[model samples]
Target: MQVSAGQAKLGADQITEAERGLLDFVTIEDGLGPQSSRRHEPDERTDQVRGRLDAVLIASRVAPLTRHIGLVPTVVATHTEPFHISKAIATLDYVSAGRAGLRVRISARPDEAAHFGRRTIRRTDAPDGGQPITELFDEAADYVEVVRRLWDSWEDDAEIRDAATGRFIDRDKLHYIDFEGRFFSVKGPSITPRPPQGQPLVTALAHQTVPYRLVARQADIGYVTPHDADQARAIVAEIRAEQQAAGRAGEPLHVFGDLVVLLDDSEAAARARLDRLDTLAGEPYNSDTRVFTGTAEQLADLLEELATGGLTGFRLRPAVTGHDLPRVTGDLVPELQRRRRFRTAYDATTLRGLLGLTRPANRYATTAA
Candidate 1:
């Protein structure tokens, strides 16, 4: 899986030209940020850095311009309504011909909460105080459940479109997902039809137990940051255990390691490049994932080593987009291909197919049958 910042200044033409069937999935991150306490101040200067372009909308625009690349855009589950996000992703799947996915996120920042003003969060010294994180995760789980139900609300053959009989749809095939939970309730028979893939992929980035459980219970794929093979193994084990506890042990769950990479012809060159970048920025770049400064061949070796710890793939964060993205596509991908680790060409059309996931049966259809 390849990660790209959705808010980056990447033009449609650039994406079309750069995509040469090298990437399996291009994750467009919801760039909503500058969530500092200072943002809440009544200052006009902070406003300039506040808002971001909607990631799903950007993915929708890019869908028609590219083929065979999975477009997974980030959507925050906390502040947004589930009904809207569900239909939006379903529509994306339709437009992308079943190549849509969502990167699920939850907002914990007070500044982010300030944007909505739906509820006020109070901070305390207690372990469970200052806004319950577990509650947020629980709400996120409910949100995903609602979204999945909405996706399955309409059956595959709901639309008849019969000219002879003047039948447009089978009303019986449409289901009302009467979902009620602590956060919100949605009575959803989504406006959009059943997506081509039945369900678009759900993914989340996880670091600890709370998020690991989210991945186990809700996501198709989980992105993890591990400093070493031991950490990778430990994280994967925890997630697997969570899956077992959730009674989804048999399900296909991909745990991918996330890494920030700066690749060059040699390790020395890579280090030099990163150092220069840091110097230009006036601070060393820190990341949740381990930063890799090495040659493509060296990076391949590291990936193969990490795979031994049960990592199915890597979500590489390019330190510099123009420089590292090309190296990943042109250099690292070819090296991995040569090592028989990466695919030479895309074998499947749909994102789920590319990920080797079967299209799930509609829940309502199964119940009716």
Candidate 2:
């Protein structure tokens, strides 16, 4: 029942402050432009601007400023090289002392292709002779799997010091993951040592089978959108089945239901607020899943109901970030704690701890016979 703030166009400090309160996780959007829309303006320069206000810089600042908040910055695996991201997340873990997570994003838009001078990758349905977009998504899953392996190429105790013998590291503790996939090839051992958390955290959104496979086999957390409680249970069950098939049933793979929330003290007031916002925007905002428009208490109950159906948590999208995030952190969190559903104070310092997850073993560590 812990809350988190998804990416919003707010100052870094305000965002960090909100997480410091009762919110346990903070996801910072990195390098994502507006979704593909025919009428959207040309964003040739937006990419540069995004790189300027880099998510890593924001995370570094947020990590030190807040004690127990989980700082997860998005890393686009398609356009950005894994080498850079590995170092960045490792550095973030060092600075944050293991409070780092990553929202693994794959570039799905064709316009984004221009930024890298790569051909516009099309989804499965495109007329271009390219492989189906679905297949590309599968490739993306492979890409993240490779990144995960690279993150674990070095054991937690790989770095050793023996000034007397002039030895600085135990080479046996270092591993080569030499991973090659249909989309990319990566040679072993990460430039940086294993992150402070061993492997920090990797998460992704799964709207289809491709991502579901990735989430089942790779991610520590998976963000999923389901229509109702029944659908939520079904999705969770399917992912659990997939995990068993992939030999990852022993790992704690959290599935959080994704929702867009508009809260008020009364149900009528919340509905009116959502209606007014949609009217202000001059269009009906039809989301992929149902929107929760009610009091925080009512929303909390719905979350609990959904939880019973198998979801471990919820990722709320505020109708308007500036307006609703404060309510979520200030209002909803207290209500949940009052019910003894959410944590009152952080019981642990690390992000993994906040989530009730242990620091995982280094993947390179294998028992010798």
Tens digits of per-residue lDDT, candidate 2, 303-338, equal: 888888799887787777777777787788888988
Sequence-dependent TM-score of model 2: 0.89
> Candidate 1 on 243-299: residue-level lDDT in tens?
999999998998889888899999999999988987875668787789999999998
Runs in model 1 lying further than 4 Å from the true structure: 1-14, 31-51, 122-130, 367-369
lDDT of each: 0.82, 0.78
| Candidate 1 lDDT score at position 311 | 88
Candidate number achieving the greatest lDDT relative to the actual structure: 1
Q: Which regions of candidate 2 are displaced past 4 Å?
A: 32-52, 125-127, 161-167, 366-369
Please give the lDDT score at residue 335 for candidate 2: 84
